[model samples]
Target: MADTAAEAEEKFIAEAKTRVSFVRQTGDALSRDTTVTQLVERMITHLRATVDDPDSPVRPQTIDRYENTVAILRGDYAGGKYPTIGDYPLSEVTEDLVHEWLWDVSVIGPSMGAQCRSAMLRAFDLAKDRGVRLWPVNPAKEAKLKRAPRHIARALTVEERERIIGNVTAWQTPRKRTDLLSIVRMLADTGMRPGEALALRWEDVDLTGAKATVTVSGTVVELKGKRADGKGIRRQPFGKSDAAYRTLTLSSEATTRLLERRVSASSYLVFPNDVGGVLSLRNIGTRWRKARGAEFDGVTLYDLRRTVATELDRKYGPAAAAAQLGHTSPAITGRHYIERATVVGDFTDALGTLR
Candidate 1:
């Protein structure tokens, strides 16, 4: 697998398996049924070139996802994995082929394998429209992916959260890098994503009236650049879904901190660099790592959101927790954000019973 290795290559398939597994129909020529039209049709072409509708163009993210799925399914183009699979006729493709390919990908993780399966289904739907009916049913649809153990959101204790923020508070004004700590606190207070916190503006925050709320309307998204996709930045609503664009009630701590650090009307972004430009997420992360050091290695900005979400779940229940986190469903929040380790019963009642 590499330049130097001490171990033998682990073989997945047995040499003398009774049932047929992977069949390489190399150099197989398609029967000339409709001259030029039949020769050009392929899964790769539909994914890369074919437009979904006359009016609505395919989303750029869709293209990126399909390309990745194609790489995993058909393998590399310039010779690697199983390059020849791309050339296989849509009519020749089968469920067994997709299952085996996805099985290979499952080694990475179940989520990845599941996503690949869905991508293949989309590609094959294009094939269906093209009249390339392999079997009576769509082959890609048959591929099943079992759910693996997913990593739940990591939450910090109240002391851990305070201690980290306390460290950040030491750095004073005019110092630009110290802004990372403020952003960290904002994430904890509002449960806004790191990018959302970075993309925040002074106008979005309301420091007056009976209630203080920050309108989380936009987030920093990296779209398709000149080189590749998902590279450029833009302040856009609905970074992931319609639910992402939401208004969150700022905690008293958050309100106080934000009020102190509110920039002038001339500057728009709440957390800008020295030149009033947006600070990059990576740079902020580096500062956070240094602030936490070895004591909080695994904790992240998302974990700060997790901490807030856990408290939300405790106080208000799942619905409130989901709304605050901009989750479309309570299930996602319930699955990831809700901490399972703590006791849930009435503590006062339990104390009385203990007495």
Candidate 2:
């Protein structure tokens, strides 16, 4: 019986050693970059190194997002079967092929389509920087996005705004409802984008000065499913235009509304989530829809921004309005807002004067 037990133990030890050897062999194979697949593998190795480096700002979540995007791109090339990156030639990527790839997925929503294009663009950019002739030209730069149609900006009518605010005030759970109303009022008064509004921290707002400056400094945003993995977030100014980044003087009403909200003294976020983190744009949008009720159509959170801009144009001259809205040129303001009925009102009254 002792000899039989000893034989079984010896067999288990041998099998364990064999398994370890097999694992070691696989690791060794993955480590070498002898072919195109190896080069692709190298990209992942570089990404992982970047993600793991303590000094690097790239978060693990961001790295995961990039990895998933790369996996999708690679999987498409591997005949639907997962293969090592070394299996494919890096030189075969061309602008035409990328265009086709984008078109193939064009049925998806614009936001998602844009994200996929952006991901592929980043990969090609990395390859180009490394002196790899993978793509003839960056497809993202060359690919033509369909022009978005022009639509009239929807601002809340005076009656509608009153009704919505009244309804929100009467809600039993007025926490989110009140917050949305405040946000809408702020947007309508300040002409800030939904992203910019959500990104605002309490420190950024100077209540005494009644001025809010939106600079590209310290604004953290999750780009393409990427999250801030303990690395300090990158701050991007409101917009590229000098006017976009400038400080704006807030109205008394705006200042009053901000002060009314019970925010934590330690909480930096101006518009935080329930847990005092950054508010999700999706949640804000959903809540806004509910607040407006069934009668509201075509009105979006963005429309509050338009409303502010239009009001500014009416109160101030075109140039002043453009400056307030952070537009570099009056041309854009005119094209987007000034020409719209919501901004200019009915021109039919002017026709009678001409007659």
Predicted model with the maximum TM-score: 1
Q: Using Cα atoms with residue i matched to residue i, what is each candidate's TM-score against the true structure? A: 0.72, 0.62
Estimate, for each residue in 171-222, the C-alpha lDDT of model 1 and write its tens digit: 4345554467777778888888888888888888888957688888767755
Which window of ten consecutive residues has the lowest lDDT sum in model 2?
Answer: 28-37
Q: Model 2, residue 295: what's the lDDT? A: 69
Candidate 2 structure, TM-score to reference: 0.62
Q: Measured by TM-score, how close is model 1 to the native structure?
A: 0.72
- Residues 89-156 of candidate 2: C-alpha lDDT, one tens digit per residue: 45554576566656544433344345456555665555554445544576456764443456765555
Q: Top model by lDDT, which number?
A: 1
